[model samples]
Target chain A: MQAILQLLVSGVLLGGVYALGALGLNLIFGVAKVVNFAHGEFLMLGMFAAYWLMTLTGINPYLGAPIIGAAFFLVGLAFYAGLMRFTIYKPELTQVFATLGLSILLQNAALVAWSADYRTIQIMPAGWESIQVLGAYVPTNRLVAFLYAVAILLAVLVFLRSTFIGRAIEAVSQDLVAARLMGIDPDRVFLMTFGLGIAITGVAGGVLMPSFYAFPSVGSFFVLVAFVVVVLGGLGSIAGTILGGLLLGLVETGIGYVAPDLKEATHFVLLILLLAVRPHGLLGVKGAEKETLK
Target chain B: MIEIRDLHAGYGDTEVLQGIDLDVRAGEVVAIVGANGVGKTTLLRTIAGLIAPSRGSITAEGEAIGGLGAHRVVERGIVMVPEGRRLFPRMTVRRNLEIGAYAARARPRLKQSLEEVYALFPILREREDQLGGTLSGGQQQMCAIGRGLMALPSVLMLDEVSLGLAPIAVKRVYEAVRAIRDRGLTLIIVEQNVGQALKVADRAYVIQGGRVVLSGTGRELTNNEDVRRAYLGLTEHA
Candidate 1:
């Protein structure tokens, strides 16, 4: 019974991490309709940025997040202004390969500069890395990341609801022509969204770095998880992301508990089933998937 | 005060608006009427800066605005309520109206613009919280126009406002257009619906094959045999 409870707690926490990771990707995809293949790379870069910031400046990732967020926001802008701006209006395939190439370039650059040595920062006190709660041991870093996810997600929802620019972003996401007619600059909205999305991704990485390793190819792994999460939750549906992540987390945890060897296989299987059975995702706006690709 | 001199534009290679000359005086209801696929939309789109003209000049209040981007054109107070009543479907009606006041010029007067819009279309006030897509066809058109007015536009260009609407809905929309004219806003209306466009228009232009074949007072064109036979769809022919 304890083991089952532990699995449940672990699943919820794990889902939180995935939710945070997928949020940025979904935001960019929702507004710009650009599926960023380099999303994981952005997260990986954030992890490294946090790691280096810790090692060099002695600033904790949690506390130094704002700085990382601001920097990544600029990187996100450059990503759009320098490269994505050109590919965005092109064929969907062009966007696919462009982001893929970026992923490759970023991974290689990180490998050349930092080497493949896995890096992690032990932020929690000794023996306190795991905290007991409801008869389950929750990793301290995971709990912290989960809290961040909840706060950020709620904040994002509020931002989307209450703010002018946020509504403008949502406006652009729905109809570019309509947005333009409203005097809302779609290009500017895309720029802001990319910046905001990448910034969140960077912060998510920094917050999760203590729980996960920071490596050059780390993004490749998380990118798949993000894609699964985004698809499963319903692309462009912000609230739906939480449900999707939780479902993925629970299934994976359940699988991991019963058959540890098949844990990784669950993601792929769920992705396939979700795509085949319900392409729009559980709560996604109908035909959202078609709107982007077509 | 918008002037188009020999405007030439098109979609990549095949030119659509070939050396078309048109004029829209300030505070006038000008209508551009034509049959289907006659580049009516293309002309409005070009004027809105969705497509840059290959040649010719567009001057509004003495400022050239031929090839400016859509957002830029909007910033200069020329907003187009596009064809198909392209409301942000998922956004609430209030949010849709709010987005219309997104430009720098409109932002300052957002509250006033919104109130004006709600006053113009009382139905929008009731539908404020409803999703834009959920509104009926007529309501959506009004919301689209309300959104355009939210921009505090110096000149409002409406593209096919009556298409796909029921007769009563179309009448309501034109009534709203008349009310907007009473508010002293310059309007450039594109219509395949000839009679209605002419009725609201102070001056009307008859466009054929991408060029203005005829221009006169609304009554003059309304009474013309060519316009009557070609467009009014009154006299049946084999």
Candidate 2:
């Protein structure tokens, strides 16, 4: 029982990071209606940014998360202004290929810049690493990441619910024409959404740096995890991402215990089955996948 | 005042508004009435800066606004309450009303606007906490019009205000529109309901095949034999 409880705790902690990662992707998809194929590359860049921040300045990645967030926000804006602006209104094929092309370019760029070294941050004091919670030992870093994830997610929800710009983003996501009629610029909303989405992903990357490795290609692994979480959660729903992540995490951890070698295959199988059975996801609104921004 | 001279606009490769000229003076309610495919919606859309007019001039108070984006046009005080009440379904009625006051120009008067909107549609105040999607069609149209009024626009354009509503609900909406116009706001009403539109408008235009086929005072056009034959489906005998 304790062994199972330990896996559940670990799964939930891991799910926190998964939720954070998927939230950004969902935001971009929800508002802009662009399935950002290069989302994982942004995570990779963020991890590198966190790694470099620590190596160069010795600032803890958690402390450097805000810095990474701000930088990534600018990177996101530039990405939209330079490339996404053209493909934003185009067909799904155009958007898919455009982002896929960007993924290749960025992956190779990171390979050229950072090489393939896997790095992790050492943040904990010598003897105080794990905490005992309900008879299950949990790592300090994982707990901190979980708290940060939940706090940031809550903050995002508050922002969406309270602010004018946030409501405008929601307005655009719900009905673009109606939003336009209200004098809200969809382009400006798209820019802000992209900036916010990428920024959140960057912060998540920074937060996860202590628990995970920072490598040029590590994003490919995470991107798939994010996709599973997003699909399971419901596309474009913020709260749904959390639910999806937790579910996937528990499932993956359980599978890891039962069939450790086939753990990775579970994601694809679950995703395929979920798509076949309930493509709208567990919490997603009905017919949402069919609703495009244009 | 707004003017459209030889405006040509269309979806890609298919023209919808071709060589259209219109002049709407301040404090005058102008009605554009036409059949379903006769470019009534297209004209209002182009005027509101949703669709860019090709090979023509759209001047608002003598400034060319043909190429300006919708948000900018809104800043200049031209707002549209679309045909279908396109409320943010998941959002609350209050938020939907608040978003209408989102433009910088209207932000300062947000409080006043909200009060005025609520005053015009008192039921909306009662249901401020309710989701916009849950409202009946009549109530949704009221919220939509109320939302447009929240923008504090000088030139308010309403597209098909009576599309899908009961007769009494339509009467209530028209009454609110009449009240709005009495306050000296310039209005452009586009509708397939010729009688209702003409009744509320000061001047009227009959559009066919993307061009203005006739124009006169609301009563003149309403009484015109050709307009009756074409729009009202009334023959010489009737």
lDDT (Cα, tens digit) per residue for candidate 2, span B1-238: 8988999998888899989999999999999998999999988888888899877999999999987989999999999999898999988999999999999999999999999999889999999999999998999999999999889999999999999999999999999999999999999999999999999999999999999999999999989998888788888787
DockQ of each: 0.77, 0.88
The candidate 1 chain A region of ten consecutive residues with least summed lDDT is: A285-294
Model 1 agreement with the true structure over A1-294: per-residue lDDT tens digits: 999899999999999889998999999998888899999999999999999999999998888988999999999999999999998788889999999999999999999999999999988889988988887898889998899899989988999888888988888888887787777777788899999999999999999899999999999889999989989999899988888888888889999989999999998999999899998898898888977622
Interface RMSD for candidates 1 onward, in order? 0.9, 0.6
Q: Which ten residues in a row are the worst by lDDT in model 1 chain B? A: B229-238
For candidate 1, the TM-score is 0.97
Q: How much does each candidate deviate from the true structure in C-alpha RMSD?
A: 1.7, 1.4
Candidate 2 docking class? high
lDDT of 1 by residue, B157-218 (tens): 99999999999999999999999999899999999999999999999988888898899999
Q: Per-residue lDDT for A1-294 in model 2, tens only? A: 999999999899888878998889999988998988999989988888888899899998878888998999998999899999999888888989999899989999988887877888788887768989999999999898898899989999999889888999999988999999899999999999999999998888888888889887788888898888888899888989999988888888889989999899989998999889888888887777776766
Share of the reference A-B contacts seen in candidate 1: 0.78
